[model samples]
Structures are given as C-alpha cells and as structure tokens.
Target chain A: DVKVTQSSRYLVKRTGEKVFLECVQDMDHENMFWYRQDPGLGLRLIYFSYDVKMKEKGDIPEGYSVSREKKERFSLILESASTNQTSMYLCASRRAVETQYFGPGTRLLVL
Target chain B: DQQVKQNSPSLSVQEGRISILNCDYTNSMFDYFLWYKKYPAEGPTFLISISSIKDKNEDGRFTVFLNKSAKHLSLHIVPSQPGDSAVYFCAASALMGAQKLVFGQGTRLTINP
Candidate 1:
C-alpha cells in the first residue's frame, strides 16, 4: 500500500511567523502537489512538483511556496504566516497521471 | 470563474435508498473525470473515475454516468449506507499528462439510518 505522511496533523502559529509543512511519500512518485482546502472553496492547488527541483505554481499560489529537494519528499513553506493562510493543507503524490495518494493533511491555524 | 461546479451543497437519504450527486464542468477540453470522498480532517480518497470516451462506469454499488453534450456527470450510489456519508468532490483533467485536476465545491452526503 502507498503511504503519504505529513509532518503535522495540526499546527498553530503566530502571525508573521514562518511555517513549514512537510510531506513525504513512500511510493517514489514523480509528481507531488500542495493544496489548501477552505469551506465552500473546495481544493485549490497551491503548487506542484513534477520532478526533483522542479515546481510549478497552481491556481492559488500566492503567499505560498514549495520545495522538492528529493523525489520522495515535498515541502510547503509559508514565508510569512497570516490569519488568512490558516486552513487545511493537503499534500498529494501521483505517478503517470494516476490517482493522487494524499496525506492525512495539516490543519494550520495562523493567529 | 469556476470550471467545475457541484450545485448541491448537501444531500440526505435514508439507508437502502439511492443517492445521486451531480457535477458539471465548463471546460469542454476536459478528458478525464474523477470522484473523491473525504472525511473530516482527512485527505480526499479516490472513489471512481470515467474517461471521456465512456458514457458510464460502474464499481459495485457506485455508478458514474457522463453526458458529454450536457457537460455534466453524476455519481449514483445505490442502497446508500451510513458509512458512505462523506464530502464528495468531483474533479476533471483536461490533458492526460498534465494531471492538474479542477475540482468542484463538493457535496456533503448524509445517509440516515
């Protein structure tokens, strides 16, 4: 079975603080993605990395960035956390246009 | 502009009844359509999928019907169970290789026993 793990299931950070949400997939998938889920807004992609050191901005990439240093791990970085940035952060990894296996998700609360 | 739309915010059905969740997409170029089920605090899970070439796909009690002319698709769950209650999100991908999916707002499904 493929397993996708996130660094934190729930996190609380103060305003202006820098936040890092990590995601790791054991399947060695080539494509990884980061998305933020909000009520009534569905899942909006923040960024996606198709290969190591390669990344592309998605629908809502503002105020967020991602790092894919290694193939198995992808990291989402919040340069400066703000209240509006608080939401359910989900990470996913897929291979060859197949179903994207997702992590449990990180619920970030920016205060 | 929303490409994928799930007009129904929520739906309720009794056990052993049928639950129909609808989704519509504006982009005619979309070639792949998928459904995902999500629980509270958990990531969305793959439910079922249909290719543009096929009009219907079925897996157990779940059946997905696609109407290309209407730019719409629907997921039908027969004999709905309480365990099936979750947030159903409809997604579409235009290009096969460019697998970025546009998702709908999602419909909360509740099964009353």
Candidate 2:
C-alpha cells in the first residue's frame, strides 16, 4: 500500500514565527501537492511540484511557498505565521494523470 | 464562478438505506469525474470515478453515475452503514495527462441507525 506521511499531525505556532510542514511519500510518485482546507471553502491548492526542484503556484499561493528537494519528500513553508493561516494542511502524491494519495493532514493553529 | 458544485451541504439517511449524493459541473471540458470521502482529521480518500465515455461505474457498494448532457454526476452508496458517514467531495478533471482536479464544496452525510 502507498503511504504518505506528514511530519506533524498537529502544530501550534506564534504569530510572526516561521513554520515548516513536511510530507514524505513512499510511493516515489512524481507529483506532490500542498493544499489548505477551510470550512465552507473546501480545499484550495497552494502549491504543486511535478519533479524535484520544480514547483508551480496554485490558485492560492500567497504567503506560502514549497520545497521539493528529493523525490520522496516535499515541504511547505510559511514565511511568517499568522492567525489567518490556521487551517488543515494536506499533502498528496500522484503519478502522471493518476489518482492522488493523501497523507493524514496536519492541523495548524497560529496564536 | 465555481466550476464544480455540490449544492447540498448536508444529508441524513437511515442505516441500511441508499444514500445518493449529487454533483454538477459547469465546465463542458471536464472528461473525468471522481468522488472522494473524508473523515474528520483525515485526508480525503478516493472512492469512485467515471470517465465521459461511460455513464456509470460500480465498485462493491459504491456506484457513480455520470450524465454528460446535464454535466452532472452522482455517487450512490447502497445499504449505507454507519461507517459510510463522511464528507463527500466531487471533483472533475479536463485533461488526461495532468489531472488538475477542480473540486466542489463537498456534502456531509450522516447515517442514523
């Protein structure tokens, strides 16, 4: 079975602090994605990478950035944490044009 | 505007009954549709999918129906169990090579015994 693991399941950070959320997939998939899910608004894509060192901004990429240094790991970085950024963050991996497998989400809270 | 829409916010059904969740899309270019189920504190899981070429696809207790003319699709779970209660999201992808799925707002389903 394919497994996608996030570094933290729950996190709390202070305002103005830098935050890092890590995701790793054992499937060796070529595509990785980061999305933030909010109530009523649903899931909005933040960033996606098709290959190592390659990234693309999604619809809502402001205040967020991503790093894909290796084939199996992808990281989402919050330059400066704020209260507005608190939400559930999800990481997913997929092969070209194939179904995406998601990891257990990380719930982030900024105080 | 919203490309994919799930108008219903929530639905409640009795256990052992059928639960039908609906989804509609305005983008005519969408060729592939999929449904995902998510539990609280967990990521969404792929449930079933259908291509434009077929009207229906079934897997065990879950079945997906697609209507190209109406640009609508539905997920049917027969004999719905308590475990089947979750939030259902509908998504569509236009191109085959790069599956950039546009998802709906999602519908929360509750099963009552």
Candidate 3:
C-alpha cells in the first residue's frame, strides 16, 4: 500500500511568523502537490512539483511557496503567516496518472 | 471560472437506501473523472474513476455513470451505510499523464439508521 505522511497533523502560528508543512511519500511518485481546502471554496491548488527542483504555480499560489529538494519529500512554506492563511492543507503524490494518493492533511491555524 | 461543479452542498439518506451524487463540468477537454471521499481530518481518498471513452464503471457497491454529451457524471451507492457518510469531491483531468486535477466544492453525505 502507498503511504503519504505529513509532518504535522495540526499546527498553530502567530501572525507574521514563518511556517513550514512537510510531506513525504514512500511510493516515489514523480508528481507532488499542495492544496488548501476551505468551505465553499473547495480544494484549490497552491503549488506542485513534477520533479526535484521543479515547481509550478497553481490557481492560488499567492502567499505560498513549495520546495522539492528530493523525490520523496515536498515542503510548503508560508512566507508570512496571516490569519487568512489558516486552512486545511493537503499533500498528494501521483505517478503521472490521474489517481493521487493523499496524506492525512495538516490543519493550520494562523492567529 | 469553476470548471467542476457539485450543485448540492449536502444530502441525507436512510440506511439501506440508495444514494446518488451528481457532478458537472464545463470543460469538455477533460477526459478523466474521479470521485474522492474525505473525512473531517483526513485527506481525500480515491474512491472510483471513469474514463471518457466509457459510460459506466462499477466497483462493488459503488458505480459511476458518465454522460459525455452533457459533460456530467454521477456516483451511485447501493444500500448506503453510515460508514459511507463523508464529503465527496468530484475531480477532472484533461490528460492522464499530466496528473493535474481540478476539483469541485464537494458534497457532504449523511446516513441515518
């Protein structure tokens, strides 16, 4: 079975602070993605990496950045955490197919 | 523009009854569609999928129906159980190799005994 693990299940950060959410996949999938889910807004893509050191901006990439230094790990960075940034963040990995395996997700609270 | 849309925000069904969830897409380019189920604190799980070439795909108790002309799809669950209660998301991909998915707002399902 494929396993995707997130660094934290829940997190709290003060405004203007820097925050990092990490995700690792054992499947060695080539594509990884970060998405923020909000009520009525759905799961909006923040960033995605197709390969090591390769990144692309999704529909809502503002206030978010991602890093993929290795094939198994992907990190999402919040440059300056704000209250509006609080959301349920999800990480997913796939192998060049429409099927994606997702991590448990991190519930972020920016106060 | 929202490419994928789930018009109903929530649905309630009695146990042992059938549950039908609908999804519509505005992008005709999408060739792959998927259904995902998510719990409160967990990420969405891949439930089932259907290709544009086929009209129906079934997996045990879950069945997915696609209408190419209407650009719509529906998921049907027979004898719905309480365990099936969750948020269901509909997603679409233009190409299988791209691995980029556009998702809908999702519909919450509740089952009563």
The residue-level lDDT of candidate 3 at A102 comes to: 92
Give one digit per residue, the lDDT tens place, for model 3 in A52-86.
Answer: 99999999999999999999999999999999999
lDDT of all predictions, in order shown? 0.94, 0.93, 0.95
lDDT of 2: 0.93
lDDT of 2 by residue, B1-113 (tens): 89999999999999999999999999998998889999999999999889899999999999999999999999999989999999999988876545667889899999999
In model 2 chain A, which range of ten residues has the least summed lDDT?
A93-102
Clashing pairs in 2: none
Off by over 4 Å in 2: none
lDDT (10s digit) by residue, model 3, range B6-113: 999999999999999999999989999999999999999999999998999999999999999999999999989999999999999987455789999999999999
Candidate 1 local lDDT, B1-113, one digit each (tens): 99999999999999999999999999999988999999999999999999899999999999999999999999999989999999999999875566788899999999999
- Model 1 lDDT at residue B72: 96
Give the Cα error of residue A13 in candidate 3, in Å.
0.3
- Backbone clashes in each candidate structure, one number apiece? 0, 0, 0
Runs in model 1 deviating more than 4 A are none
Candidate 1 DockQ score?
0.80
Q: Which pairs clash (backbone N, Cα, C closer than 3 Å) in model 1?
A: none
Best-first order by DockQ: 3, 1, 2
